[model samples]
Target chain A: MAPDQIVFWVFAPVSVGSAVAMLFQRNAIHAALFLIVNFFTLAVFYLVLGAPFLFAVQIIVYAGAIMVLFLFVIMLLGVDREESLVERLRGQRPLAIVLGLGLAAEIFVTARASLGLARGPANFDETVNVGGNAQALSHVLFRDYFLPFEVTSILLIVAAIAAMVLAQRRERTTVEAAGEAEV
Target chain B: MKTPISYFVVLSAVLFAIGSVGVLVRKNALVIFMSVELQLNAVNLALVAFSRLHGNLNGQVLAFFSMVVAAAEVVVGLAIIVNVYRRMHTANVDDASLLRW
Candidate 1:
């Protein structure tokens, strides 16, 4: 088998296993650690997909910044809050399982339904080779996707302000959750 | 040599399913949050895969933007979780069901 196939086979199981392990982990910190493993695996996938820029961003942002934040919050909350996996709601576990399978089927069909998608990996290699992957992506990012890029800055600033407000305000009112403008 | 795009599509589907299941089954608020992040990462992986298949960078750009959104999301989300814990003294979603104190 090709080295590409080998890498894919290796990381794919590892990623899936770690994510599955995370679900079973009652401890938040352990789950966070499993997620870190999954993130690193996805970063490897980014590199394998020829997204060198995204690979770096994945590590710096997802693995570094985001995971750190998750860990900090988990630790602050304390680890003893391990959840009891019992299904209080009748058939909740079976229901969740069925829903998960249905979601996977839907995603599979929808993703594959698109036409013009390739069978094997694409060959933007020449483009990527032009002064390397970073240079090529910079062109697409700055020129083609300029407007959305600029708008993201606004979204980020707004999110920051919302977080600050929510954290500072002392209240149990669930209305404060409106500030939860998450995603 | 390149791996098949189908591999990534399948992997992403499976990962997303796992993430959703995690969200549904886990009672801990933080674990649910992590499950959400896992879902996002699964989509990101698929986006990168599509970017490779199309021989274009558009998908990657979208993925990048999603990452930005995710970062912002985590910040606000964590704050909300912390606040919920402060008031209810527990981060379990079922326990914090009431909209108000």
Candidate 2:
């Protein structure tokens, strides 16, 4: 096996393992940590796939910014409430079993189909190496995909305003006072 | 030789399934939110893989758009979770599920 394939084999298990660990972790903080592991492995996978621009974004945005946001929320909300893995719903167990079976079937079909389609080294390597992945992507992003690029800012602005609106906490003092008055 | 695209797609499928499991089994709203993020990342991986396969940058560009959308979604989703916790005294979705005014 080439070094590239070797790198992929090594990291694939780690990404899957961390996802599993995140699934079963009781503490929200610990689950977030496991997810960070999963994200880093995903970044590695992006590198392997020849998307260097994506690799950088995965590390900076997903791992750095997003994980920090998750951690901040966990800390702000407190972690004393360690949740259990047992399903509270009536059908979760059976649903999980069905999901697992479906997953296996999907994997089998995907592997067979994709194997025949995309063999060996990727063709993106030519422009990606010469022009640089980020530069090539930027050209396409600006010229061909200008609409999507512009839309990102609009979505971000809306999300920010929505978040601000939702985060405005009503005073607890009045709520507690009302409770006392009711009592 | 580089790893086949199938390997990456298969990996993406596995990750998406794991994320789905997290969303289904976990009751904490925060954990569920993280699981959704995982699912998004898994799809992003698949998109990148196909971009490489086609020798085009569109898939990667779409993945970039996906990441931006996920960031915005996380911001709004966490704010919603915070609102839920503030109102209900718990982030546990079971106790926090009512929409009654």
Candidate 3:
């Protein structure tokens, strides 16, 4: 196996394992931490796939900005762990069993279909004409996809305003009494 | 020889499936949110793999878009969660059965 294969094998498990852990973690903070690890491993996977731009964005944007937002909300809200641990499915065992069984059957069928199919070869050649560097990305974003790019910016702006509106409403209700007294 | 592209694709599918299960089975809102992020990452992996296979930059570009969207989603989603928590005093999505089955 090549060194790249080794890296892929190692990091892929790390990503998937942490994601599973995040799913089962009762504590919101612990789940967030696992998600951070999962995002970092995914960044490594992007690096392995030769998308350096994606690797950087994965680390900076997803792991850095987004996860921090999640952590901030977790801290601000102070989620009560014990209260969240109460399972609501006291009598839903049969339903869960049926779902699980159906999922297993689907996986079995998928695996059977995929068996004996010739795996596509990996393209390790880096000298390809498709430039994935930042410069190429800028050109595409500004040229062919310019309209969509601008639309995305507007979408983001709208999202920010929506968030602020939502937060401000809560602040208004919570601080109403204090505001009335100060006025 | 290096790991085949199929391995990465299969790995991504597994992660995506696990994330889907988490989204479906888990009651904790935060876990469900993280699972959604996990599914997004799985798509990124698939995008990168396809980029490698086709010798094009489109998949990487889409992955970048996915990352940006994921960031925006987290921002909006967390804000919503905070709002929900304030009004309901709980994020137990299962008990959010006011809509009813």
Candidate 4:
């Protein structure tokens, strides 16, 4: 097998394994760590897929910012205690397992069926053009996709404000409860 | 020889399924949120794979948008989780059923 295929084989298992580990981990912190591993492996996959810009963003945004946010909440709430695995709703676990398996089978069959089809358009090539991955991505993102890009920025701003508002409300309620208790 | 796109698609599918199972079985809202992130990552992988297959950058661009949305989602989601914890003193989803008739 070629080196690329070998590398893909190795990291594919690593990513999937860590995801499974995240699911079974009782402590929220440990689960977050496992997810970081999964994200890192996925970043490597992005690199192999020839999207260098996506690789960088996957590492920076996902492995760095998002994971830190998850860890912060896990620590702040101290909800790291083990969760009771017992299902509150009857048959939830069994139903989930059955559905997951069915989904997996469906995807596998579809993938196998499509294996014989021709690859994408012949004019398309994987190599970087005169510019690099970042340049090409920026060209498309800033020009053709400008509207969605701007909208994404707006969504982020709204989310930040919402977060601050929610946190402030929590603080206010806590202070009010403490004051009432003192009175 | 080029790696078959089907391999990447299959991997993405499996990861997504694992994430779905985590969402279903995990009780902690934080962990459930992480599972959702996993699912999102799976979708990003499929997007990138198809981008490579088609020799276009659109899929990668969409993946970038997905990541931005995910970051914003995490910020809002974690804040809501923290707020829930503050009010209920627990992260268990079942415990937060204040609207249950």
> Which candidate achieves the best lDDT against the true structure?
4
lDDT of candidate model 3 versus the reference: 0.75
* Candidate 4 vs. true structure, TM-score: 0.92
Candidate achieving higher lDDT, 3 or 4: 4
lDDT of 2 at B21: 77
Error of 1 at A124 (Å): 2.1
Which prediction has more favorable TM-score, 1 or 3? 1
- For model 4, residues A1-183, the per-residue Cα lDDT tens digits are 876689889999999999999988998899999999999999998887887788899999999999998888888888867998787889999999899989988999998898644345443433532278888899889999999999998998999999999887634578798999999
Q: Model 4, stretches more than 4 Å misplaced?
A: A115-129, A169-183
lDDT per residue for candidate 2 within A1-183, as digits (tens), equals 898789998999999999999988888899999999999999998988888889999999999999999999989989558876466667986798579659856886968764764654445578554588888889889999999899899999999999999999775698799999999
**iRMSD in angstroms, per model:** 2.1, 1.7, 3.2, 1.9
lDDT tens digits, residue span B1-101, model 3: 25566666777777777777777777777778888998899889988877776666677778877777887788788888888888887877876677786
Off by over 4 Å in 3: A83-125, A129-132, A170-183
Order by lDDT, highest first? 4, 2, 1, 3
Tell me the deviation in Å of residue A177 in model 1.
25
For candidate 2, the TM-score is 0.91
Residue-level lDDT tens digits of model 2 in B8-95: 8888888888888778778899999999999999999989988887778889999999999999999999999988888788988878
Model 1 pairs whose backbones collide: none
Against the true structure, whose TM-score is highest? 4
For candidate 2, the per-residue lDDT at A28 reads 89
DockQ of each: 0.66, 0.68, 0.49, 0.72
